[model samples]
Target: MAITDKFSSKQIFKFLPIVAIIIAGINAYYTVNEGHVGVIKRFGEAKDQQPPGLHFKIPFIETVEMIEVRTRKNAEKMASSTKEQMPVTIEVSVNWTVEKEAALDLFKRYGGLSQFEQRILDPRFRSATKDTIPQFEAEQLIQDRASAIQGIERRLTEEMAGFPVIVDNIQIENIILPAKYISSIEIKQTEKNLAAAEEHKLERQRFKAMQAVNTADAEAQSILKVAEADAQAILLKGRAEAQAIEAKAKALKNNPLIVKLTEAQAWDGKLPATMLGSGTMPIMDLRNSQEKGN
Candidate 1:
């Protein structure tokens, strides 16, 4: 029994150093997750920065803090007013990331990400949004919303200068206005639409009137042309009749016997029904034979 006890005590003393070495090895190394960086601190002072994956540190002397370097979102809702003193509620979201080069500075200044946001980012974002909202009217906010968003983003980015976090994007998620104001705008727009429709109706009426006047003028011109043509035809016909009468009168003046010849052409070869006493026969060449020779 004494021989067995001596052998167990010797084996136990030999494994003590091995057990301590394994425990120390386990406490010396740490792993940083994907998209995360580790910051090393020695005796509560920032010492060095480490990238993702396995890293070694002095156990119980140096501490490692894992900071997510990936993009993070911070959203806020604020109540503000327009230039017209119209109350509005706006929701804004900011996308940010810790700068790898400035991680140690960030850790030193704010002590952590939460403290950085609370001390710097959130307050500046609220201030920027408040300052911008008062510069715009309610209508301008609705009409030129994109410009409003840009102004807020510019101001926020400007405020974040020299900070350890990078401002990737700023978005205005929602803008809420008073219900009464929206109803008034809708009413005004409806009136404008009605006025535009009325103006369009008047234009159509004017166009129709112009078309009717043009049609009447064209009809008048057609009638005048037809009357002129008919008058010209009548004048030509009267002139032709006068010319025929003048030609007949000229032929009679040239030969007086043409009238007797024309009358004999129209006479019948029969005796008269009755004759007066000592009256010569009608249209007869009753001259004597000696007179005819002279």
Candidate 2:
């Protein structure tokens, strides 16, 4: 029995080194996934960075921590006051990622990603939003919303420059104001619209009045033109009648017989009841006088 025990003990001693090596190998090597970075630490101090894929470390002396370096999105709802002291709720989305070159410093300072966010990112974001709000009024915040959003984003980028993380994007999702303020603004806008409508109506009335004045002036001009034409026609007709009378007087002066002949032509065949002059009546019919003598 002693000889069998001695053989078994030698065999166990020969396999013990192999078992120890196997255990050390299992603990020495680790794998980092794509889009992740490994921070190797020695004696609780960050010593080196490891890229993705398989990496080895000293067993029992070195440790590895994986941090996601890819971009991540965080949404926050923050409250702030505008320049006009109007309280507002702002919904913002931030896309950020760890700077690969600053990863070690980041890990050393904050210990972990969650700690970094809690201690640095969230506070800085809140501060930037709060600081930006006071620069604009409540009405401007609602009216020039896109400008306000851009301002907030620019301020956030400036604030985050001191951190080890890069802010990829900042989006202001919404700005919500009080219901009473909105209602007041709507009422003011309605009043403005009514005033504009009244002004337009007055302008239309003025235009119509101008049109009526122009029409009246045109009609008066037409009537004046017609009156002038009628006056010209009457003057021309009077001149023509006077010319005919003057021509007849000239003919009577040249030949006195024309007057007697004109009188004879104008008589109707009836004898005058009494003679006004003691001269011969040129218009008397000689045949009638002869018949009366016989």
Candidate 3:
């Protein structure tokens, strides 16, 4: 009986610590921080979610699973650009969050925030990248990269629909092509530049030709003006000579002294042997002397 009593006391002492530990754990409450949500699980399955606050759950049978409630970013690089299989490196990031309404179900299926990338998110990203990028050409993808990234986002969004993951954005970083194609493009551009230069030279020649034509026309006009002036001067000189002769004829026909002088001006229709205006007094020449001697 003494040994049984000693064993009972020892058992009671062990039982007291167990009871205290149970009470303390059951009454404990924890506060959820920013960008986090608390999921209360019963027997390893999610039963309820607690918002950002200090909350309690049955400690022995219930456990709280902490999950990130904020949006998350994931980056992926695609190996090649779709059409030509040119080597390309794509840096793509997606912004995602767990939907508030589906938090419990999501936690139940996916376990925790740590299981997200492998189980639910990364596969969707890979699938979307493979399917969407293959439909686009390498050059077109490089030029319209934004549209390509947007298409990836849309595809992932569609694929992840009805799930707790909400994809916000996707991006494509860089695409690289071969140097041979770039060199070919440069050569073509240089040829076009040479052709443009030749055209400009021809245009300058045409302008110079037009200028030469104008210069010739101006010179011709100046020569014509000089010829016209010479013609007018010749006409005026002819008129003056003719008018002087006419005035002299009219004076000789009206005046007797002038008629006598004009009649004596002729000597057998030859040049005069005696001077007509050389002497101040009357000096009889051949015709008057001959008439007097007769």
lDDT scores for all predictions?
0.89, 0.88, 0.80
Best by TM-score: 1
The C-alpha stretches of model 3 lying farther than 4 A from their native spots are 1-27, 176-294
Stretches of candidate 2 exceeding 4 Å from the true structure: 1-20, 192-294
lDDT of 3 at 140: 76
Worst 10 residues of 3 by lDDT: 266-275
TM for candidate 2 is 0.60
Residues 1-294 of candidate 2 have per-residue lDDT tens digits of: 999999999999999999999989899999999888899999999988888899899998999988889998888898889898888998888899998877888888899799988888888888887888778998888788777767777888898888888885677788899999999999999999999999999999999999999999999999999999999999999999999999999999999999899999999998875545666754444666788999
Which candidate order results from sorting by TM-score in descending order?
Answer: 1, 2, 3
Q: Pick the candidate with the highest lDDT.
A: 1
lDDT of 1 at 292: 83
Against the hidden reference, what TM-scores do the models get? 0.67, 0.60, 0.57
lDDT of each residue in 1-294, candidate 3, tens digit only: 999999999999979989988787766767788778888878887889888878877766787888887888888776655677655556677888888767777878877766868888898888898778877876678678887887888899898888877888676755555677667767977999999999999999999999999999999999999999999999999999999999998897788698778677754677556665666966556786788999
Candidate 1, 148-216: lDDT as tens digits: 888888999899998887885777788899999999999999999999999999999999999999999
